[model samples]
Target: MSDSNTTDFTNPSTFILLGIPGLERAHVWISIPFCTMYTIAILGNFTILFTVKTDLSLHGPMYYFLCMLAITDLVVSTSILPKMLAIYWFNSREIDFSACLTQMYFIHCFSVMESGIFVAMALDRYVAICDPLRHSTILTNSVVAKIGLAVMLRSSLLALPFPFLASQWPYCRTNIIPQQYCIHMAMVKLACTDTRASSYYGLFVVFCVIGLDVFFIAVSYTQILRAIFSLSTKDARLKTFGTCSSHLCAILAFYIPCLFSALTHRFGHNVPLHFHVLIANVYLLMPPMLNPIIYGVRTKQIRDRLLRLFTHKGT
Candidate 1:
């Protein structure tokens, strides 16, 4: 171990990741669930991608947005799970500085992309239910592509400063990160220099990305509700609402855990470190695992297609 008080102001070549910190004894046992969730996440997301790609019935704006969500989920989960599993299973906790920064970048970047996709999906739902006549024309292939490109650019640009800022700091402090992966704040806290700029910028990005996304989603849903309630028949309202059930489930699955993790990290001072670690892991893994199942169960078209697929394979 390098001396913590060394005079060197240069960044460390490698950082030690203490997976789950205080629960080191339970690392092996804990890895079982993480590994399971990761496997399920991978298979579930790929299934969504393949099912959408091959099915002509699903070739719509909504399904295209779903494909984007699945891809984002895959990237988000893949960015952190392998390294986290390694820490738990083999005790391989040393991460190269540049690799750590890259992991941090992907994890955060795709997460924002995921949030943006949810907002797009919400708007797609709003248009579908509220303006069924113009839905097809409004969210055309060109428009969808543009939205995708914009989301990618927004996420990439917003996330760039996290790693860039981290790289500039001199890590005279210990390079031991308490979490399983290199979180932005975790890495920033290791710097010997002041990190308020990074901290405030992080807050800015959170409110700018997540807060704005949430507001838009709420507005979209509000409009959707007004449209639904304006319908004359109860059956019509129920039918319309059922279409949005899957999306609502997905949004809750993502944002709830995400907010919990962030709040716990920033404000839950009384919370145990292991609990924080576990919630953080859950925040990353849960959405990827749940999204496909949520859609499969709630969406009649997808459910029917999946059933046909399984029955065909069984024959």
Candidate 2:
């Protein structure tokens, strides 16, 4: 009974969310940047979605995958930011325990889905460039739908265990989560129980989702480069590489900060807490903010349409 009492801080009614520990005095000021980021992400993603849906010329598999990406970005950004803003502006950080788990589930699910979309987009580029003749036949509307459904299922199933495992542990430590949002690792750390299972499972998911995605994306790009070099005409090579530039930039934007954040969380014990928090924020927020810009700048079709839309409206 004493041991039980000692270990079990079970069924915590609420948990406090620490927005930024070292910068609590400045959360009001920090919200300015956060608000700007949220605005850009929403507007950018919505524009992409609107452009893809309205433009019949963009009905190809590539754009179909891109539409899915835009939707995912919108859903992900919305899932994390509202309550976060509430914390910063209203000091409403005392979230119900159940609400935190729900947030974690969505955050994890959407992140995996986004990664899956990236892999799918890479494959789309590979076929479009490397096997242009068969691209249409291979990536029909039906196949694209299947890919979307499969990714959704994979992300949902894989992330389910995360919150389940978290809820199983009795929370003896402080119930304050040390991040802007309900991150899986941050929640897991507050549990007094042994975290070996959660750690290994998290690693397993990362390998299966992120590691495999990186490997396949790398292979697809390698084959694509080989195909481009083998092209007889410079014009043909330039066109093919140009088609891939937007996706490649988005990939770098999404992965680099994420890798750094993951490395810091695991190995950088001496790293400042604020630095870790900020890096994680970049990983969570930057890709959604930048992907639309990358696509708009690199893809002539998107840029031309956007410019024409604005020009027509101005007149």
Candidate 3:
């Protein structure tokens, strides 16, 4: 190994995360809402998991996929948020290179998993609305299980190379990552080596997973709209629309900030660094907290179950 004393391209022993850069004086105030969101995300997602797992009436394929979504959101949120809170609260922003890489791996891995599950949920909605008679037969337990396994495998295998390729480069430069958590490009950009390949692969992964998923979702919704229009009664169409609004909100909450963040990062050179960092946190933090609440309040069955749980406790 090169001398640590030299300014050569040597890998860092530890990286200091500069959370929300110029907002150092306000980290205390910022932590209030972040802490609340984290707590709500944890508690809300657990409630969904528990409600779905224990309720016999929710044993359908739709609820099963919902449970899977809750699990994914839970894992992703847990992996990213606590560390962010630590940075905000205690100034605990130092992270080892290997540990940082590990965090990056899981963040990318679970993000892809979350996207895959979104596609799966879209497919479920498609089948249920477009082909009601076959929905049950098509999305049986075995089929859902098989699809879940494929989703997990695809994300895990594809995202495996991100951290590996990032770690391949030597990091002789300063070790201050200007974000709350270790992200793919942010960490990779610190290397004093060629990172064009990492950038290209990041885009490739985005297209392969989220791009493809969004296309299929659009097709599914097209068919769904046709199916809804074919119905004679307005009430039927309205009811059908209501069943899907929650998922639509969930999708927007997940993807809109993500797309915006990516765009600003690539092209918004004049954009403030604090804005970029805020958006990164929004996309990662908002979806997990919002999803469960969206489903719990919007879906009548889950709402009823939640009410029953609270009512029983009250009694």
Candidate closest to the true structure, highest lDDT? 1
**Candidate number that wins on TM-score, 2 or 3:** 3
Candidate 3, 197-284: lDDT as tens digits: 8888888887667889888888888898999999899999999988888988999998888888877877788999999999888988
Per-residue lDDT over 1-315 for candidate 1, one digit per residue giving the tens place of the 0 to 100 score: 777656564768899999998899999999998889989889998999999988999999999999999999999999999999899889999999999999999988998999999999999999999999999999999999999999999999999999999999998768889999988978876898899999999888777779999999999999999999999999999999999999999999999998888878878889988898889989989999999989989999999999999999999
State, as a TM-score between 0 and 1, how close model 2 is to the true structure.
Answer: 0.96
Q: Ten residues in a row with the worst lDDT in model 1?
A: 2-11
lDDT of 1 at 279: 93
After superposition, which runs of candidate 2 have C-alpha atoms over 4 Å from their true positions? 1-8
Reference-based lDDT, each prediction:
0.92, 0.88, 0.87
Model 3: lDDT of residue 234: 100
lDDT of 2 by residue, 47-97 (tens): 988888878888888888888888888888888889879988999888888
Worst 10 residues of 3 by lDDT: 2-11
Ranked by lDDT from best down, the candidates are 1, 2, 3
